[model samples]
Target: MERELPKQVFIDGCEQISMEFEPIGFRFAKSGPHASRRAGDWAFKISFQSNYLNVGGEYVELVVHASVYSKAIKEWDERSAWPASASDWVAGGQLGNLRTPHHWRTWNIVNPHTRQAEIANIVANIQTTVLPLFERFDVPRKLAEQVACSQVPGFMFPENAVRFVLWQLGPEAAENCLSYWVARLPSPDAFRSERDVPTLPDRLALGSDTNNLARVARAMKIGLSL
Candidate 1:
């Protein structure tokens, strides 16, 4: 059988958070039922994208979509600005979802008084975890290499992370940079002659040991076209 809808604790959690994580700007687009603020194509502070609130505020699911580069809203930090939705700005980028996502959640705590503490913990975890990802790779090549090498025995990225980093290296080098990410493979078995390699896949298929490199080829083709 399926799980129940949002739990009562989650509902209370949403009520507590609505005050802090309010939807701030224009409504450019709707990502599921998220509350988004937008400017042209740029959107941020989108909320409720992954969680739900049931009738009477009786149940709530711990859904969140906090962006890593939110600090940009206050001041300019060029590295954090990515996946620019609108055109370039005089002060640099005003909007981005640059890195892949990494969701943070709070577990159920039936006690009413402790809900605030749970929310605080979830926020703290996200703040501490996010920026370091950007620090690891300044260029897309480094990112592509990291994604390829991430298959190490103990390696694990945040659950919300994009399997492949979605960076915006710009037209001058975007195609070249995104191209490098496609060459990585699951195993040396992929080092076959072009005629010997089977048809390349059209999309990324996680947990598939084989055909990964082939999928990369297709990712490059599609990414370049975009």
Candidate 2:
């Protein structure tokens, strides 16, 4: 069995490659006493060359639970190999599994021409036909920035999944966007008609089947009752 390496070991190992990282604070289901602050749990972020990822050229944000570091050492016997698999590494989990989480919401883009035109043309259609309408949807202007950044002559995504990856947003960016949505949406009274309705489920992580979502629980705990 491999011995678990401490946090310092992990940080030092990453330092060799110039990977920058810091601990992350987590917000639980937002209910009861745990609602106000995410003081208990911790996360870490690592930045690497965009080409290292399956989705190249775009900056990738890797978020990992602190617990994973210890688990990784035990599993792989190397502090540098913190995430065990490529998929897990990209998806904010262990290194092996790279499955996209369901909580991530998406906007689908459809086009008639498949391969006759270049990717530039396809992206252009996405920008002209889909972007304006997406702007009207509950998603905010800042969140739309990611799609805008990727709209280039040869831009291509690894897959046709609708939503962009949350991890793709730098941790700071993700926090900023999430805070903006929580502050803006939820109360229908804030806006005039349902046309401008803010549906937070589209923005935040998905909730349980009952609609008794972690966000709702946290809201209640924080006294931001809806």
Candidate 3:
């Protein structure tokens, strides 16, 4: 009897999961462990991660991730050379993190006998948790709103968020978004001590003397000053 390669087992598992995902507009890549769907200028993706060591044996541990991307936002950010944090996708996190009262979750596929149940659990999480979240931000404007409010996961900085709003909504929405963050800035006196200075993420989001936020605003032609 020929022993099955672990990679083949993983691919077979993905194929089973693909059947559930395909009807919902997601297309699983050939011989790949991810599926993606396109909606106008945006793309939604679900990717799987597993330990490399498991590839040599029947045991595999998997973590699933869901993410969204915007072609418009990517183009605008690239054209302006804006310093949005590096990420292939615009929004989303691990499937577990996005769940209510969030807790990390992983699947262990120990053998063929147990694989069906594990696959079912993973598919159910995507259907119940991931799909609804993706549906909520189906349009560009809705996604921009979430990004502007910093409610979207994976968009870590307000500067990037506001820029995304600016591109998708307009200068007024961008200005409104910037105003909220600008209002949260600490007074100059508060930064007299090194420890008092806000951290890098905060400073970038809130516009420090380095003026990253202001630079983005100018790049986008928004009139707000830091």
Candidate 4:
């Protein structure tokens, strides 16, 4: 029997996993190694990662990444002149990272003999771990709240969190979110000096300094006294 190329093996594994998720509204991308489901303006995606071992390897190690995106967040991102695409996800991390006792998780696909177990494991993780998190924030408002309150590292930054809340909720909620972030700071005077924070190009700077936050609020046409 001809040995399967690593890419083919990975692709086949992805296909199997996608099929498992299809009943839950996920559609596997025909051209990429990801599957996604759209819920209203939000999109949840599960993508496969693998370090393609040299050409003739029989085994591949795969990591699963899950992400969530929304039209509101994408629009906010575009205002910064950041390139926004259909896949402009605002929050997510590796599937394992979201689980308790967090640690990286990978599946090793050796061949047809071992592929079923690996695929089953990946599907189980998505169903039990990833989907519940995605379902918790099925709408833009819920997701914005999660980001603003927790500021999950791989999920989002405080700066973007404020913007997302502003878009999904309103300036009032945004201000409250900003205040929450400010209260978390070790020093109330953390944002006192504009000079302490270097000016960064709009596209490259997503800083949470007072000056930047105020600018972001003003850019959105809201009066923020920070």
Candidate with maximal lDDT? 4
List candidate 1 segments past 4 Å from native: 1-8, 23-35, 45-105, 126-167, 170-200, 203-213, 218-226
lDDT score, candidate 1, position 29 = 28
Give one digit per residue, the lDDT tens place, for model 3 in 3-72: 5676677777776787898887899875457899998877888887777777544577778888878776
Q: What is each predicted model's overall lDDT from 0 to 1?
A: 0.36, 0.26, 0.67, 0.68
Q: Provide the lowest-lDDT 10-residue window in model 3.
A: 188-197
- After superposing all C-alphas onto the true structure, candidate 3 shows an RMSD in angstroms of 5.6
Model 2 error, position 20 (Å): 45
Instruction: Residues 1-226, candidate 2: write the lDDT tens digits.
Output: 3432333222322232221111222233212111111211222222211112322222222221111111322332232221122222211222211222323211111122322232244234333433243222233234335433332111122110011223333334433333333333465334223223335432223332122222322322211232
As a whole number from 0 to 100, the lDDT of residue 143 in candidate 4 is 63
Q: Candidate 1 on 57-162: residue-level lDDT in tens?
A: 2333354543322332223223433322322221111012222342234344334466577677644543344223333434435654454434311123211122
User: Which runs in model 4 stand beyond 4 Å of their true positions?
Assistant: 54-58, 76-88, 100-103, 151-154, 182-191, 194-203, 206-226
State TM-scores per candidate. 0.43, 0.19, 0.69, 0.73
Return whichever of 1 and 2 wins on TM-score.
1
As for candidate 3, its clashing pairs are none
* Error in Å for residue 93 of model 2: 26
lDDT of 1: 0.36
Candidates sorted on TM-score, descending: 4, 3, 1, 2
Q: For model 4, how does the per-residue alpha-carbon lDDT over 126-172 read when each residue is reduced to its tens digit?
A: 88888877776755577667666665544434556676677677777
- In model 2, which regions exceed 4 Å deviation? 1-127, 130-165, 188-226
